[model samples]
Target: MIERPIGRDVVARQRFARLFSLGDRRAPLSWSPGLVLGPDDPELPVSVAPLRSTRSYDSIPATITICPRDNLCYPFDSEDKWVAQEGLVLPPSLVASDSGMFGSGLEAVPVSWNSLHHDDSLAVLDSEPSVIILIDAPQLAQRPGMLAEALLTVRTRFPSSLIWAPGISGPDNCALLTWMGVDLFDLARLRHASSLGVLLTGSGPRKVEETVNEDFGMEAQCTTWVQAISSTRAAIREGTLRELV
Candidate 1:
């Protein structure tokens, strides 16, 4: 169970608090009463239990932030495939353009990614999200200007919901994200780098130093990653997520 930090007003912290509360209740996440998938949607198979399914409004705070396809593997029409691959479908109205799919209520919060390119359509995207997900697809992630534009939009409307920037692997990128006030981050690119024989080491877990494969053996990456996550959870518990970065 991960303990949550009290001060940050981001949805990630909310979800962590929910998970932590469940842990305190000694509740098995799988057995928790909550929406798993849509009533009619097919369930997918995966080792890691689905995140949204395990969340319960009754047990914890209701707001949730999600970048449905963080890796951008799904097509615009691949919503079902995306859910199936991820093990559970979320509320249908999130992806549906038509009305009455699922009326807006306390169901859940849906957040989407900003395509790395500063596409002109971003203005339209501004209406929906309480929070917008800004990805640091540095090499292939969204460019800086696009991120700035989106952040500007977010600052205008739903300033309460935060910008979650992922794939930040360096001090420069971290500095930029921090300056942007990015509330949440995940080490996905580091995992991608590891899969490609590139090693990530740095002052912060999210900040990558170099490809240090010689000193840190290939097999050790998994163990080191576990330790890193453990350390990160501990730091967050102690109110030092921002400090570590």
Candidate 2:
């Protein structure tokens, strides 16, 4: 899943957070450690899609697709080569462990990832894959200490898989999260800001009335996301991401 750059030694990687191409070596990444635009505005190079079937993979879109059905997520290779994911490490929380429609508690305040358990931690250490999605990242971020520890643990476990922490990042925290080794983000927070009648900026989300730029719409949020992502990419290359954060 990683396209190692020319200068990085394998051992040197452990000392610092990593940045690299996400998938398909034939296609080098333009900007990884970047955003995966939300469904509302997907102008960026990568955006998400969804899939489910009692049918064939022939009809699925050739992009990242989230499948909610159990043991049903099978995204084809960029060339439709039918490569399979070994397994997904799903962390279970007692408060919301009922197997529901969206894979667990779709609408619930989650407990800390640490409180979840040793079993899940063990699962992570024992498995290695191309991607690891912290589905409840927004909730986890509320506890900064726990969030950092969770990120470090995942990075140590699967250094190669770019961490995907959805719903937890925007211009406000993008650089910080990137410094923690999260390679992908979604505009869930920005979209929420738009819905709440605000323009999300690097400084933070702003009130529609307070800002001179009246365009507090989705496009405005996309522009903000772009700027944040560009800054993040630049910081990663320049080795100033911690300073940026």
Candidate 3:
């Protein structure tokens, strides 16, 4: 059972900012800006364990972290210390999928919108997962019509599940994706930008090499994103979220 409460009452034309309470002790995840934190163990509110991995820690309500077949972070191992210290326990969801695309042990059945026939695609939606990850997001990004169609299909079939699009975040598209009802995003692009020595300003990514050394770092980039998300959330609340896009 997904215990998380989505504040649909505040939704302005399918847009909303809500809180996801994991447990009584842990801080409830605030979606005043949607959850776009780092993809690290400490950053997540729910305890995540791969479905195929040995249980190193006691079972907690796990949000199956899905990854593509080629993703290096496959076979995610749970840290017993984090679970014990943080008390990040969650109820297990009934939804399950068999797609081998997940690198994490989480039972996320992958649904490739472009690869599967319409009937097969509809079958995947029957599980009604709390989160639906778009495995072929890059392809969807290239084809707006396909992305819209996929988002629409999922919204129609599973109105409640949060849509996640990995490897698709930056100053360029985060607000736009959130406007489209994407509830989750990976921090890969942020890390990539940091590695390239680029600073993410409101205008866009600027090469650090071209600017003064004092203003560039991962911390600065993360701060910028946090502000952007906060601003976007404010817009959503005011029903002006589309203006940011």
Candidate 4:
């Protein structure tokens, strides 16, 4: 197998809509912006046994694993302050990222739109990273319009690297964000809502009522995710996602 570097490649495009594959070529993760992870989506999981954990994940097909604090100077935990996770066997597509405000706690450097107005942004701008994780996505979503503007700004700034806004989206705003250009999202929000007895839908979150025979099991949650992601992907391809907005 050829050893491809950690990177993202655009396989298809429709205006700002993007269809890209990223991570190691061995098990590349592919998607278009506004793609949200459900319970069973392949993921970039961060954990205490960053190295050994990834080794175990190899048996699973097509998962993207990224080690936290891959940098020798930054450790996963204070208890393991001297340990470095760089030896973790993962898809090369995971991360060989630059340091910024987060000092390398994750596979991709953590940054926020707030940095643009401050001096700290210089470090991020200077690194010219190929990928970045948006740390304040939830906060951006809370405000009326900051999220879209920030998304546009980052797209302009990087122009090439993929952008990940983890734990901040689901059926709720996937189309809106996809329209704005977010390259990645995760199921953290969906999983959390399920645990809280809430069922999420494209329209909004609804309280799951046991009296109504509504299933709140993991399988059910995964099904919801599959439907949402599938429809959004199809919309992107059909050029009707904007119509849904």
The deviation in Å at residue 83 for candidate 1 is: 10
Error of 3 at 124 (Å): 7.4
Q: TM-score of each candidate?
A: 0.36, 0.65, 0.60, 0.63
* Per-residue accuracy of model 4 over 1-245 as CA lDDT, tens digit each: 11112344566555566655443334443444533333354443221111111212343222333332222111212211111112222221222432222223233444555443332543455444434566567777777787777777777777665667767777777676667787665667777877888887777778777787887555565556556666666777777878766
Worst ten-residue run, lDDT, model 2?
3-12
* Decoy 3 TM-score against native: 0.60
The sequence of per-residue lDDT tens digits that candidate 3 reaches over residues 46-156 is: 221111111232443233333211111212222111111112211112113333222221123334453233234445533454445665666677764877676666667
Positional deviation of residue 165's Cα in model 1 after best superposition, in angstroms: 3.1
- TM-score for candidate 2, please give it: 0.65
lDDT of candidate model 3 versus the reference? 0.47
**Candidate 4 or 1, higher lDDT:** 4
Model 3: lowest-lDDT 10 consecutive positions: 78-87
What tens digits encode model 1's per-residue C-alpha lDDT throughout 92-142?
223333222111211123223222122334445433332243322342243
Residue 199 in candidate 2 has what lDDT?
85
Per-residue lDDT tens digits for candidate 2, residues 122-154, read 343443443466655766676547677777876
Q: Which is the better candidate, 1 or 3, if ranked by lDDT? A: 3
Top TM-score: which candidate number?
2
Q: Candidate 4: list runs displaced more than 4 Å.
A: 1-5, 23-29, 34-107, 119-130, 209-212
Q: lDDT of candidate 2?
A: 0.52
Clashing pairs in 4: 23-93, 24-93
Mind sharing the TM-score for model 1? 0.36
